[model samples]
Target: MFHQPNSEFAVVCRFQGLFPDDIGGYEKHRTRNGGDLGHVDASRSHLNRRVIGNADWAARTIAMIEDMKAENFADEIETLTRRRRKKQLKHRMVEGPRDPWRATRHGPMREVILTANRNWFDAPATSAARAARAQAFEDAARDWLLANFGEDVVHARADLDEQAFHIHAVIVPKVQVELNGTTRWMLQPSKHDLIKNYEAAQDSVGQHFAPLGLARGERRAAAVRKARQTGDEPPAYRQHVRTADWRKAEDTKIVETRAELEQRAEAMIVDEIVLAQREAGMIARENAIEVREQAAAGRERAAETKEQEADAMLAVGQGLAAGAFDIEDRDGTPALVETPEAKPGLLSKLRARMALSSSGRARALHVFSKALARLRKQSRDEAKTAVARDTAEIEAADEKIVEIASRLPDAERRSIGKIRLSLSARIMALTGRNMARETPERGGNDGRP
Candidate 1:
């Protein structure tokens, strides 16, 4: 699923070291009990004006995920991000073969990085699992980017630090590169069109004014035919044209109407792209939650075991000392003497007496059971919370997709004027992956593959 980014977000792929750190780094603290904490600037670093008008799906999704992890919890489980305010979670900026932060001090160095950074308060609980998942994710992302963009991606790295997890991609050339005769992008390159310049360039986009060798209306007719058959809107490539109106539009009414239509069309195109991106992210979040649930279940069990052991020791101690359980005993209690039942063994009588007098044998067992139950409840609660959060995020992703597609095309999309809701639906399917779940199709979507 495409990551749901706040309106505060902007896509930042060509980050030249300075931009990313400036926008979204962990806040630094002074001392143990310092003054106000410092935070990273989140202002637009894209250096593009039009992108400011629209938003990028992936960047927004990543931003939301990180912010969610950084929130504070008053009761129950607390995230490390909360424990130490202003201190950004540990981010691994280590340089390695696949690391994105590689340096070329002198000569000439240029590379691409598809990096991701987000804090997860609880890592030890599912470190192994996350690591495994990340490994697989990296491999898949690498292949996916290469396939979508180009094959010039020389290096790819995906890993996690204790506080925040991230991915790094290093490509030799720029994202939009000259491949053979055409151009290609890396890491959701189509998304690159979301850049400010690209959006502006599209504002006045039009054909070369001269008619092509082929029939002018053929493609447009095909688009109309598809729309009629499927009962859906026309695709982005074929839009409503002004063959008749443009010829005689000197009145203010015609001019105003044309301008309004153009703006609406651009808005629609932007919305559709964003919508698809979000749905893809939704599917991915659900999967992450399920994995978290299993991990939480395991931790809950371990914690319960420890609490039980503590109870057992406390119980036996209390029993021996007549409800005065002294933990710091010089020598642990030995069984006391009672009636010699048939004199089965030398210590049988003593063991029996101790067991009878302590009154703890039974009570201790009960205490252990109670402790286990409490811990189990805590663990289950944590799992439920995780699932709840995951559900909300996933649902939001779905909604965002709908809202984006529902928008009418505007001037920003002058050339195509409008993007097909169907195209966005198709791409949103693969956004956040290896995750699961389905949401209601917004508007009047059929929800087909």
Candidate 2:
């Protein structure tokens, strides 16, 4: 029941007026207790009355009417006096009626009551949330009145004590009239000009409450008007009314047999299966494209890693070559021999002279041996670290290449296989060179004699 469209249950009433006596009676019913049908309901009534432009109901209603009448009288008198002066200046007779305000009666005060059907508020049962929504609806309605009528709405109230929650807004109809070349406020007899069309008022109300789940009710009059304008026949449903008994009887009949229902279900299933298959194929193609992209990226990363490893290996080799020296003869034949210097530096001469003392020479040799041993150990550790780093990088590159090959298509896989073979050969060559460098005997007489 709550899921049904609210447009069918929405309500917006037209502006209706009340005379002075009627206003007095309504005030009595609202402010005081009288009967069960009165405005007050002791069992279910809640009143949130407010005065918008006056101190109380009397000032807003009866007193406001008297003040407007007095203003109208003064305006009429001013108009007459101006006309008499104009006639005298033109030398024409001013013989119109002297008492324009004598029998003029101020019209009834207009009020529009907006409320929805009872089922709307009662559907969720009586709860704090439901009450809050009802209050919000009333506030929205009041805002609508203030926006459309501005200061004309003198008083407004929301009465929740009745069967259906509703809002009552009293509007004082006043318009500006020109009197003796000066504009003055005068009481309007009716709100006909203000509310020229019922449809527009309904639309305004709908717009104000639309956010609160209140939709504009379907206007049959508008549909009829449209039909006449377009020269089309009115819908048959509008002319026909189905009785409750007939509707109930029709609902009781079985619409489809079990066999037919099964056939319809099977057809629906087949349609769904076809749609699912198409969607699955599209998904597969998209996934294939994504996998290919991932594989390509993996291959690029692996190639970059391989290049980094090669650069590291080259740097290590250069560092080792710079630290070590190759001794060769004048004819370019490898040799190792000592050559005497022409003179000794001051520090070397002092050290040679001190060698005659046994303790000094022993201490100097001991320090030199320790220093050399430290240098050799540091170099070996650095070389081992560099080799380990390169090995890790090469392994990572191989893993990436393998992963890419696994995901690639058959044709692409063959191309990757060839690249893998080339990379494996390069790796083997680098490993063999490193092994030969580590084992001096394996290098033979290449650089040493």
Candidate 3:
């Protein structure tokens, strides 16, 4: 029976570097249909007008980064410690010709286009049904982005104007992470991480759309493994040969016995299972290490935040005492005050005045201390919770590791035995066939081509 075409989901992930010179071109392509520049194709246009969420702010953002770097270079140099200055000089010397605009290897933005097999939408008879399918696909794409990248997803647009309906998303690489007991923003997720996330997103999209008759696309590795097990030419190889030619060639080759073929297939299956188990063990160890490191970092951040808050409160109290004063107005009402010349502005003056009175200062300090204390307590609590969660995760991973390790040896041995048996039987059959064929041609022991 002929089966219906499966709706397969795919995500094409590309990281285009927003160089200083290429920014204009990218911006043009994103904003307008290039007339003579040919940045965008107008011939196959389906869009009547600009769609929502199709703005080109990424180039502008990259330009802002460049401008900030240039403007702050002197300030950065002045603030750097002696050791830091030396390290910076060394890095600049070693890493030659760095692009000011491209901060990371994958640059500042990531573009992911999520599309599915065209047949999925084309098969719908009604325009409303087609629109529904398109909306479903876009929704799935948006969900994948939010789940994977969270706030890092800068912009996402569903472009029905394209030949195939797809969602185009731009993601900034910035992420807030705790490093050395401090929360800081950094450009995260290298190209490798992006690819990993993309692969995971593809799986999620498949799961999300599964009820709607969409399936995940087959992975290249899985396809290769299947081809190996089947002992047939893979799709890549089939591209070079016609089906009729391939069939005729296969007919001329000596076929293995059904029993031997079955044994070999079983051996391959067992081998694959054992390999998978080993991989699972390795992944478990890696996860355990990652979780432990995260827990350690969390504890450090909590401690650091507590220390920083204590220091800040102490400084505020010291500053208030050193700057305390009193001023009597024309009405002879004594009011706590700060020297107007000493303070920067009205806000600073008000703050200083509030800190001058013993009662007001004490109340303000108490409120400040309470807030900091609450923050510190929350940090500690979160750290503890993280530790507990990760601990459980690691323990479960360890159990899986142990279970897989225990079963792997026996599985490997059985697979090896089957493989040897299959090989020996195939060799014997080949020899017997050669002998039988030679017997008929043995009329003369003459050498022939």
Candidate 4:
């Protein structure tokens, strides 16, 4: 018999950046604290174990990584400190860049989460095979991480108390770079380059777990490519959804919408100005051409008096060449030489500018269309969610009502049924939906059906 692929037990590998100051906070969260942590089950907290290093060990490991071919950035650090102090003196809140040591967008320490589905780790207390499977998977994952990241994997831990069984490893991507004829250490995550090409990293993780019969999850790149081909937005994965992240995305969208409206208004004004300038240029060109013709006519009359008919005819011919011809003296004779087709006029220039603006508007329209489609999809999804929640709540309330009614005396139950019928009638009247009438068989043990 053919068995289905264990796609649900696919390997998950993700990398996140953390600043120097955030490392201690992560340690506190991963380790034990005395207070009641909402998500944690304190009874099973003892089961949580450190697979590798602790906070002190991680700090020391980072120091070692920094010491290897390290570059002195004391001046830069001092300057940053002075700036912070100055801001503090002014009572202004200072927001530091992601990487304070260098001009990088990501922090130095990388947080690597390695895990599979929750179902893979779940097992009964006496099920030796299932328990062994969980242990084996964790062992393989930890070994694979250490082998791949080597010394960069500073801290690794397993938190079994949470909803899932996963290993968290801190990787400090400190690579040696040859700068100015010297090998210097730099906090560069590109040395691993997992964040940029996470799909490939996921593939690698999946291959490592192949012996355990676990496949890889859906590749994000594939989904993105398919979406692009279809002119549709890629589906959002549940794992990537966080409340703060969602809010940030919403705020960004609002800002972008405002910016787009401003741009459209600016474009409209530009088009109006360009059109006015074009119209003015056309009128000016017409006037100039008319005057040139009048001047040519007057010159023709003078040529007739002086009997220079050839020059007169030539002047008329040149004037009709749409302002392209110019008269020049060639060997003591006046001859027409075509000037390089006359430079494009102000009208032509304005037309060209308007063409560019039209293209920009077209692009903006395309973006607006995409945003509209996304909003429509979001509205539909939210409506479905709301309906589901309402239905579940109503069903739960109905069950409670039936339980309460069953405990009541026969007289009281009959009275309650009358009240329920009146309430249902009122609700149906307001909603314009017909409410089903109760039959004798459907009614309780009372003569009120």
| lDDT scores in order | 0.35, 0.57, 0.50, 0.58
Per-residue lDDT tens digits of candidate 2, residues 1-449?
Answer: 12234665686555765565467656665665432343346766545555354547554566555445434443443444445664442221111112112233333467678888777777675697688778777778877888888877877777777767888777766677666675555556344444667677877887777777677866777788889899998655443222244444554453334335545677788577668767997998999999899989988996766454433323222222232222233353323221132123533443344434443333223222232233345455656777788888888888899898999899999999898889888986897688546533312334442
Q: Name the candidate that leads on TM-score.
A: 4
Worst 10 residues of 2 by lDDT: 91-100
Model 4, 25-83: lDDT tens per residue? 67677765532256576788888777876548756864564334112222222333345
* Candidate 3 C-alpha error for residue 339, in Å: 34
**Arranged by TM-score, best first:** 4, 2, 3, 1
Question: Lowest-lDDT window of 10 residues in candidate 3?
Answer: 440-449
How much is 317 displaced in model 3, in angstroms?
41
Cα lDDT for residue 340, model 1? 22
With candidate 2 superimposed using the best TM-score fit, by how many Å does residue 164's alpha carbon deviate from the native?
0.4
Give the Å shift of residue 295 in candidate 4: 85
Q: Estimate each model's TM-score.
A: 0.18, 0.43, 0.40, 0.44
Clashes of each: 35, 3, 0, 0
Those runs of model 1 whose alpha carbons end farther than 4 Å from true positions after fitting are 1-14, 17-110, 115-117, 120-124, 159-163, 174-449
- Score candidate 4 by lDDT: 0.58
